[model samples]
Target: MYNSQEIVSISNRNIPSLITLPAELVYSILDNLDMLTILISFCNVCKRLKNITNTYHRYKTFTILNLTHHRINEQEFECLVNTLQNNKTLIEIHLRCNKIDNQKTKSLTDVLKTNTILTTLVLSNNTISTDGAQYLANLLNNNKTLKELDLGWNQITSEGIRYIADALNNNHTLTILNLQINNLGNQGTQYLTNALENNRTLMTLILSNNCIDYEGAQYLANMLCKNKTLTTLILSDNRIGSQGVKYLANALYNNKTLTKLHLRLNRINSDGAKYLADALHNNNTLTELHLGWNDIGNQGVQYLSNALYNNHTLHILHLQYNKIDCIGAQYIADALQKNTTLRELYLACNKIKNQGAQYLLNILKNNQTLTTINIQSNKIDFHEIQYLIDILEKQRIQF
Candidate 1:
């Protein structure tokens, strides 16, 4: 047995001091850690480590500037903004669910004026009204590096959207913009549609859960007819009815650049589905279509199935929660036999019974292209599930 002094000597000899290591080696270890870990664990360990972590280049793409769930006050937010301004390497900043108002937004805009490396900024679930939006729009006029901006669930109304539209008319580097769950009525949508006519850089636009009516849908459809750069459009959970679907279908027949369209949780019915089917027969560029949670019944499924027999480019189809019955499943199963390009099919939460499940299982025996089929929450029995598992196991071996 050794004495206490000898034990201390042995432990000290075994454990080398991390602070005594070379600066280059310490930086190499800190470079592998994420921003949150570095900030929380190493930033306050010593002055030297904090300086080294601040200068690390790996933080260029550091995401999640999240203040949500943390009781951060104004002084802390200002300090954070100051730190961000000094570090010229950050690429993304997420300020979601932070309850930020116009006063807080001023600090962010001040940093945006000089920060040239940030490309994505998410300000979702805040209280940014017209004044805050104007500040951001003003920054957009000069900032050239920002490419993606998300302002979902904010208090942006038509007046606020107008400011953003005016900025978008001239800004060229922004490519993706998300404004979902705002108060963009017909007037605001018109402003955006008009701006899109001249803007050439934006590609993806999301307007889900907005109060856009059929008239507003008409404005966007008109833009789609002439806009050549936009490829993804999400308009889910709006009030666009069958009439709006007809207008969009007409535009889709002539437009050739859009590749993805999401119209989930709208008021579209069988008539709307028929109109979209007509458009699908002529449109060749669309590869993904989401029409989930609409009241498109068996009649609507029949129309879409007939269209899918000839449509070759569509690779993904989402028809979940649409009250589809066994006959509707049969129609889709028949289309799966003829449609070769479809790789994914989402049919969950419908009224598909055992017969529908059997029909799909039988089709799966020969369908080699389909990689995924979601049929959960249906009326399938235990035996049907077992049979499906057996068929999938066999297919796995065959492949």
Candidate 2:
């Protein structure tokens, strides 16, 4: 009903318009905001803003979950999934600690069915069960872009692990899988070991805190003897006893592809240590060995010292909290004089006294290859620690 002049005047008045801003400038501002903030606050402001936020280039790595205790409700999860469907540039998604259950996982797996750009998916600390894992396993069967999948601290039991293991047999693109703190006992370990025997693309496997016993360890050891693609294996906090260590040691003598092995808190005693030491005498590909929190005493340290004197590829050794007394420290110190390839040594939380510290300091003063050495939480006094620090500083080393 207004006249032409009045309508023109109203339109010409001063007004703020985000749509008038250059697209490049808007993108620059959005680049500084977190994905959650953009998704929750900015995307639904208007059609223009939604279009700008949904641009795939703005989200190559989207992390929208609350890592703390804050829970994302079902509606927000649906919105996230819808956004993911539009983002063709997203390469990584981290949904850790989001309380995602089987129903919510369907939305994610549905997007993954056609997602060709996503390479990493982290769903750790969720409420996913056997059915949810089956959905993910089905996705793995045909998905070619996914390389890493972290399902740690979920409710996946032996049945769920079997489903994942079966999928792994056919999956050719996945390289890293994390199943830590799951309820995968000996039976689940058997399934995964069978998959490792034939799978060629998997490179790193983390199965820590899974309650795997000696039988499970034996199964994995048998697979290691023939598997060629696996490079790292973490079996920490499992109950693999001395017999399991012996089995793994026998495999290490012939395995050529594995570079890192973690057997921390596995109840390995001096006998197991001797077995590993004997295997190290012939092992050529292993570069990192973690045997912390075991019962390897002075005799075991002496055995490892002899092995270090001959091994050439070992670069990192962790022997922390293993009841290593001053006598054990002396053996390790003497071994350092002959081992030139070892670059990192962790000996913290031991019983190394003043004399033991002196032995370590004397060898470290002359050594040139060792870049990091941890000697904290031992019986070495403050003055001795300061002296060791001074010597390392003089040699430009780290402790």
Candidate 3:
């Protein structure tokens, strides 16, 4: 943090000051600073400082520029993008919660078209709608190096998604796409899945809270039958009822690529859990399954517990906020005795009382594979929690 202007002005006279620090010391300082500070201020100090910055390996490798929630406006955002236009080392830029609108998105698109190094762009929680999406869609066609794009919490409608879907057909580098909380209903989901059938590079697709129901899920199920690259699909907070779950479960039987599926808050009930449980019986590829905030009761938990007996691949299972009671907890506890591959189990916000809690705590003595087990917000009182803590040495138990 040396003062650059008065490098020689002890003038008060001519003594060597901290501003005359060596290149090595300056490089060490650059290692800890963000890209904005290094580029906008440090690099502008002098020719010597700029040269030292260009050669700083630590600075060069610090590629991610995250300005999330900075609340930057149009002029500031344009200036920021313009400053980063020619940066070759930055690979990711996060601008979430900024006040970027359609015009600012255009500025970003224009800047990103020529920047070959940047691969991830997160513009979530912004004000960009349909027109802004079109700008980004156009950028996708020109920028072949971008690998991840998060446009969640926007108002990009079904119509805007069409442009992105069309662009995906030709785009080969983008791998992760997050469109969560966007009002892209069934039609948008259809467009994206149709394009994904041919696209091979994309692996993670998040479409949570999109107003999609059985019809939209059916399209995705059909696409999953043929697509062999997608690995993670998050469809939480939709209307993917039991019938929708049925379609996805059938697809999972054939899908050998997907490893994670999130269907929380989808209005799924006992029938839906049964469908997914049946799929888990034969499907060995999925590693994480999130089914929280549903009505998968004791019967549904029983069905899933039975599947866990034979399943060897699943590592994480989230059943939180479901209508699971003491019986459901017992079912899960019984399965843990034999299921060694399962590592994380989430049973929060359930109705499991002392008896059911004891069952799970006792089984943990033999089940060493479980690294994480969340039992918070359940019906177990503080005394039972303290009892478990004493037995587990406060090291193994996390309540």
Expressed as tens digits, the lDDT of each residue in 1-399 for candidate 3 is 448667545454565443577988887787788767776567655667777777888667778888888787655565566557656688889999987789889888988887788889999998889899999999999998999999999989999999999999999999999999999999999999999999999999999999999999999999999899999999999999999999999999999999999999999999999999999999999999999999988999999999999999999999999878888889999999999999989988888877777878878878899888888888778585567657663455556
Report the lDDT tens digits of candidate 1 across residue range 1-399: 999999999999888666666778887888687666564456556667667766666654465455555645675566676576565656777778887898788778887877788898988888999999999898788889999999999999999999999999999999999999999888989999999988899999999988987999999999999899999999999999889999999999999999999999989999999999999999999999999999999999999999999999998899999999999999999998989988888888898878887777678888888878888888777464575768563433211
Model 3 TM: 0.87
Show the lowest summed lDDT stretch of 10 residues, model 1.
390-399
Q: For this target, which candidate reaches the highest TM-score against the unseen true structure? A: 2
**lDDT of the candidates, in the order given:** 0.85, 0.86, 0.88
**Runs with alpha carbons beyond 4 Å of true place in candidate 3:** 1-62, 382-389
Q: Give the number of the best model, judged by lDDT.
A: 3
Q: How high is each candidate's TM-score?
A: 0.86, 0.88, 0.87
lDDT of 2 by residue, 133-196 (tens): 9999989987899999999999999998898999999999999999999999999999999999
If ranked by TM-score, best first, what sequence of candidates would result?
2, 3, 1
| Model 2 / residue 229 / CA error / Å | 0.6
Model 3 steric clash pairs: 10-13
Extract clashing residue pairs from model 1.
none
